[model samples]
Target chain A: MTSNQDHLPTGQPDDGAPRGKVIVSVDAMGSDQGPSVVVAGCARSARSDSDLGFLLHGDSAVLEPLVARQPALTGRCTIVHADETVTMDDKPSHVMRHGKKTSMWSTIGALKSGQAHAAVSCGNTGALMAVSMIQLRRMEGVNRPAIACLWPARGKHGFNTMLDVGADIKAEAEDLLAYAIMGVTYFRNGFGEERPRVGLLNVGTEEHKGRAEIKEAHELIADHAEIGRYEFVGFVEGSDIPSDRVDVIVTDGFTGNIALKTGEGTAKLVADFLRESLKSSALALLGAMLAKGALGKLTARIDPRRVNGGVFLGLNGTVVKSHGSADATGVAAAIGLAAKLAQSGYHGRMAERLVIAAQAVQNAADASAQNGDRS
Target chain B: MTSNQDHLPTGQPDDGAPRGKVIVSVDAMGSDQGPSVVVAGCARSARSDSDLGFLLHGDSAVLEPLVARQPALTGRCTIVHADETVTMDDKPSHVMRHGKKTSMWSTIGALKSGQAHAAVSCGNTGALMAVSMIQLRRMEGVNRPAIACLWPARGKHGFNTMLDVGADIKAEAEDLLAYAIMGVTYFRNGFGEERPRVGLLNVGTEEHKGRAEIKEAHELIADHAEIGRYEFVGFVEGSDIPSDRVDVIVTDGFTGNIALKTGEGTAKLVADFLRESLKSSALALLGAMLAKGALGKLTARIDPRRVNGGVFLGLNGTVVKSHGSADATGVAAAIGLAAKLAQSGYHGRMAERLVIAAQAVQNAADASAQNGDRS
Candidate 1:
């Protein structure tokens, strides 16, 4: 489906800041509404960034109409005419097998084959993870891949990055250490943190509490030299995410997924509750006026849409997974997030650091083994 | 230890309602603070409920001064003098083997032997679950045991029942059905609902989502006669716990724990944030004054202390697990709750209902197996 000769037109002039030429392959037919929203998002992204090029992979007929709607994107976006699309309900194995023909699969293939700098999709997360793992594979010294997302916090547009949203359901202590290192790198590079403080998600702030894995992970991270660059602030709970307690929060995928959705669900409930309370009666309305500013600031600052996507870490290349129900704006934001990660070199830095840490831990263990200090 | 015959003075006559004869066995020396707070909580509980009795198992000499401070409790509460106490850090297996003389063991024994109606503790949950599994055993026809708790919801001063708080970490679909039946029965009897609506926690309200287990469990529950009795609303998210969405929300223990704790942590954080915002400046103080009434009402409704305790269901008897960090008042409220559960015959009735339902499901499955009706 690489018949883009007819669609290719003159590219835009380079802007002041030398924008790195990034080819982001879009799964044009993956989302709930098919290629329409994806095409729109890619069009928006391409128009805003001159160096960013889009290799839209889907049915050309489906793309032509959507492309017709956006005149500005006609020359900027390339259509890779693929016939198949991956449904959200399809098994991960099926997607992995026939992913070459499907838009989502082809997108990952583009990244792996060096045709695209990064790939972005709002399709089945399981399929994305599986296909990406098959095509791109894990980074050096990384055991498990993690999905890291930005959690907006309390400061001026304040946010903290969190990882292992839904990559591995069951994780080990070493998996958590990997998440900590990846999350630290994601934040440091993507958000420009010098030394991000990593907090382990636990039931309490105590050292001995939480699951067995987190406790062991804490010890491993604390002793690792590369991870030592990250200010390991021991343990933090789910509430600490929005309170500006730490720069990065690390957890297994199961807990992290629940926490993320819970936060999203609660925020919506709170907003709804406030609206209902405000409109219930005249007295309540008057009371609402007093809270209007503080409440507005809080909600705006913590808006999930502003940080609408999560980057799957430990993979060989950048692959951002937008929320399945993302609108055009959200998908665009995800594409932007993928671009930032591609430029940041966060994954490379994190991979290099992880190798050093793992080697050091292995060396220490080996020395201790000689000394008969297994405990 | 049960030798104080004169201390069983039962006459706190004529409060109109029947004064329940409840004997609560306390593991007086297991928590982080040892027996100090637990003894204080028990003493406070005894004073509050005149008909309440305790088999406080621990060193009688150590508990004597604490028990002495409460004159009213001295009459009804008897020290079940056991010198040993289980340490929190001890392995569950170790405690099970060498725990005979330990206060935690003795107190549970009191319940199993029918000396007490229920058992209460702030000790290690893993140990408690293990001990209870061995001692009390599962109710008749129950396959796997689950821990249930009542989380406070808005509206009436009632609680919504949730189960498998920490009993079974990784759950099967059938396991969730057991949790549902147990949760509903507990809600009906303990919380006085005739037919509680059961909502399964999922990422979204869609029919074809969630991890594999939740999806399978959803169908099983829909067809089960016991589950059919309740208003089986399809799916609900974590945020619905606080607001009135369902009478009982069912999930695996892992997700349930995170959701419950996240709700708690969110409430605490929002409350803390508001309080801090109020004290920030004079202008903020004026705003706070304007919104004080609504905020106060909101805070009171969402206060964690009001619903500090949770019931550990699916046991052969009643057992309540209060928050480890619960204060005297919170402990007293939990004790009061346990007394009410005993008075209501919640556990026995729930067990009876579950037996009937379990038999029906097994019969249906057996019939299907015999007929070779795979579909």
Candidate 2:
């Protein structure tokens, strides 16, 4: 499927010029619905953004044909051949050892080698996380990497950022402090919030409640907030996650993962209940038809497809992991998010902010120690 | 406000007869709505069940005036005056020290002295748990008592039981094993299910996921499932909490509390969205009016007030803690649950089940040790 002729119809008039364009690496394989969705999503994204280019990584034989169908992605796409694919069931360690030739590995490799500004994939979460960590490496002074997802909320931006959604199960107080800084920086960069409010996730909002590590992290986060350019809302409970009370919620991976899934499950249950209720009676069915426009607007506002990517934070390069079962629309949303972060230069800015926040936490620790010695 | 007359109109003809009656001790102060709501709830409960009685503990000046308004609860209620009340902000340690005169203390004391079969309270959770732990004591071999709340689910009973919602922030492997046994016994006794399906709450359903203690607890629970008379469904994710796959979900207090609150917050959010949409346009309002009956049915099925009580498990006596902001309907639901558990003799049967399950776990550990030595 390798095309001898590279030039095809461009949907936009300025697409032929490629100077100062942001290039995103796309893994066009291993999605539950196959590479056609990835090509369609890329084509859709390219139609909307004239300055975006793609380095599509997969089997060129299969991807070239799919990309050929989209006139908008024709002059903008480049296919790199990858012989192997990473299955969803493949272990992360196994992928790290024997996944060099897979599309996921090559896609992230483009970001690591400076050929792409960001990477997007809809493959195995563990394998993608492992590959991203090993290939991209952690930023300087970063102890653990976190995955930050934008949850639909009642905030001004219509979304709130939460971190450590399943990167690792354990976090020390220092790791939690790092999460707070990273979350603040990501939210500000991704959503253009100047002074995001950061909250530590706990069982209770009181300072004295929760585990010892969370309490310590709370104090540390509060101390570093001023230097980090964010407001520290002492402690917030799970109920505050979807509220406008805070812009960023920080927690360890275990709790964050559980809360994330629980929210998704509850949303699905409510939607199911609505559907069943609408079909319960003849009168209800007629009423539903009359109210379809209003209900459709509400559904669009809460639809999971609108916000479809989990951005892996604290790495040298940005990697957005989409849902494995996402269709073209979901994949396009993920690609759009990746392009937005890449354009904002979020990685460099986050690195600079994290260094300052880390120093502030260290200084506070030293000051407390000296006071202890004097007393 | 104390009344000298003891006779009032009986809602039922045989209300004066008190043979084979089950009594529930209720702390009639500290609810957000006041004692009038509690009296109304008790009167509503008495009108429905003739075999139920109440030992009302509060200031007689406040409670007698309210109880006198409910003719159905006139002769069936016995007032025990307690001068103090536990404020919501009161610390548990302070209550244990200076709270003997509080109505919460006297309410639990009634159960401890065998004057009532169970105790119900809508006061401070920390103070109530502290008072119950001190007054009734933990059952033999029980390390930590858990607070189990019935979650709305798709199960046959329409609710699944979840433990350690907020009792304590930590749970050892042994404590988790004890929770498994206690949850099974409580579900079986409360819901009349001969065998309950139990799942260990974790971030994933995989055996290798979650913390170390959870992994160990999983093995122990599996081994003791037969003697415990429950089916061990292994690790379940947070999504399964509202699913029909399991009847009992067990976790540490920290995770369980967060999941519970998150679910509550999300449900409220969806309902808020629906209400906002219905009021968005005149056509939508008309449609909603047409479908009022079906919508009301849906709302009732998911109402938090219908399932308002969180039973304190693994205690020497049964204690039901209602929501602090519960209204008359919520209080009636809590009273109904306390009455059900009291009539079922749940406390004594839970003790017997705990002993057998604990022994089975110990024997399994010994067998594994001997096998290791032989190997």
Candidate 3:
């Protein structure tokens, strides 16, 4: 591995960008496509946005030549070499106990130490969450961290914000309230939507439907809508996730994880079936040829890689998780999302908003308990 | 309301078929398309399957002319006039209390009195479930009724069976185990799969993931795999819902309902986006015309109307809930599904399988409690 002195120091203005530019700390190892794609993605971002820089963490022996090959990243990157990598199959507990030398840990370290504003990794989700919580720890008054994703839907932003996709399976009423506030912040910052409408995910839209925790969450989220700076849509069914009725959806990780995967699986299934059907005849082949341009456009619109990042929220700093199998294009998308969040100064504002949400939840709990006592 | 004698009696050699033919009692009112579609759908089925018969429940004034218009139903129909109809906005509890005169209630009555081998309705889901539960009651040893659906997927059968989609949102460990057994039985009897692979839906595939109920259900379902007459694949994530790995997915109604709707929403979103893209350019329009046959084939394969019924399991009699907005083709498909179940004698076998499942769960609970005492 190359020594730290081999790279330029922070705010050296190597790329003609100011000190206030957002620098994304990237874990350039462990992904299926390897570090070449990661370097290419960083170069792509650097080529598009002069105000963005990258602090790439990996084995410099492997990464140095890759970075040198990209002229766009010649003066816009700082390689922070680490000796090890966290494999996809590594257990979160095992990695947490002994993974300090890994590139993923070093990437998060850059964020923790303020060397970078945001972090991006294509590592195992569980291991990343464990390392982030152990190193940077949760934000003030946050019991559990959440992972938020942009769901492609019908809206001004073309996507709806959804949280707790797989951070943890269990979330009590209070935790859901915290997610509501965090999701609102994410939508506003990432999508540039002011006062996004939020909804609680449930089996039905009726107040009496869903589990007890959901009912409690409904009351808490609705009661503090004014403080959260979002309109409370009360409850929404799964179909509403992609509808224009709301801009943000909040749910426990168990439900959110399944909903996310189910949506992806359904889309993939449709695509597969359509391809097979299109190949069934000569006429279809000719038609597919003529419609290739239109079909390509549709493919681009629904491509998961175009929206490839899940932000780990309720943590001390923002960490975006890209798909492990993502190529250069997908990795670049994730980095772009991370840079946007960092540029908006989302980290500082998030802490302030979450504290207020915590207080509102406590007050709601107290009022509910008093009513329970009376009954 | 017309008198009961206005309708033909059961097994009166009506449709030129023998006494063993499957007869579906259909609620011919309250659907978004009204009684005309229901009558037309029945006529369509009667034309396709010469052995099929219908027990139609609705206003005789409206249904008589519609049924009489179709030559296929010349001697194949029986009309049980029901003046009242349950609207979509009616409360389930309210319907259960004062819905005896409603068409939905009358349709369930046909199943209860054994006047029809099976029941199908396009009424409100909540109202339909409520009326069926009261009229037929739950089967012995069944705790909560479940609504099972055929999820379109890739497999030998082209679909997977999922249960507890909406009947009840809360399913305990024992209830989930029951669903596993019920799902396997439904898959076998409906699709003729000798031994379907079953999986419990959870946040992840790991043993340590998900809530307390899921963990318990995992153990209970795994322990009684041999007795359940299916292979227990343990836990499955959301993406596996459509994979070839599992033929049956058992989950609580809350998660199952959300997953179903989420899948539908994603599919619709893709279709809409694809349509918009196809219409964007003249070249694409010409291509679409050339590929029209193949595209139509794809649409037919994934059409919801081709699989429109949601079967209410754990009931003394079989009941299928069709989509409220179904056309004649959709209604015909739902009635076809109901007729298949009735022909297989699914109601009687489901009861026996559920009783054995209950005992298995009880045995596991007792053993666990004994271990707790030792601890």
The alpha-carbon root-mean-square deviation between model 2 and the true structure, to one decimal in Å, is 6.4
Write model 3 residue lDDT over A1-375, tens digit each, in one string.
Answer: 012111101112223322467889999995898899999988877877788889999999999999999999988899999999998778789889999999999999999998898899999888999999998899986998999988889886778878889998879988898898888877776666779899999977878667899998998889888878899998998888888999889998888999999988888888888889889999999989999999998887778887888989999887999988888877888887777666656666778888988887777679989999999
Candidate 1 A-chain TM-score: 0.89
**Can you list the residue pairs that collide in candidate 1?**
A153-A158
Off by over 4 Å in 3: A1-20, A59-72, A81-84, A89-94, A367-375, B1-19, B68-71, B370-375
Q: State each candidate's chain A TM-score.
A: 0.89, 0.92, 0.91
DockQ of 2: 0.60
By DockQ rank, best first, the candidates go: 3, 2, 1
| Local accuracy by lDDT, each model | 0.72, 0.84, 0.84
How do the residues B276-349 of candidate 2 rate in per-residue lDDT, one tens digit apiece?
88888988888888777778867876778877888999888879999988887788788877776766666667
Summarize candidate 3's per-residue lDDT along B168-264 as a digit string, tens digits: 8789988898898888878877666778899999977878667899999998899888887899998998888888999999999989999988988
**CAPRI rating of model 3:** medium
Look at candidate 2 and tell me the lDDT of residue B9.
9
Alpha-carbon error at B92 in model 3, in Å? Answer: 2.7
Q: Candidate 3, A219: how far from true, in Å? A: 2.6
User: Which of candidates 2 and 3 reaches a greater TM-score?
Assistant: 2
DockQ of each: 0.22, 0.60, 0.68
lDDT of 3: 0.84
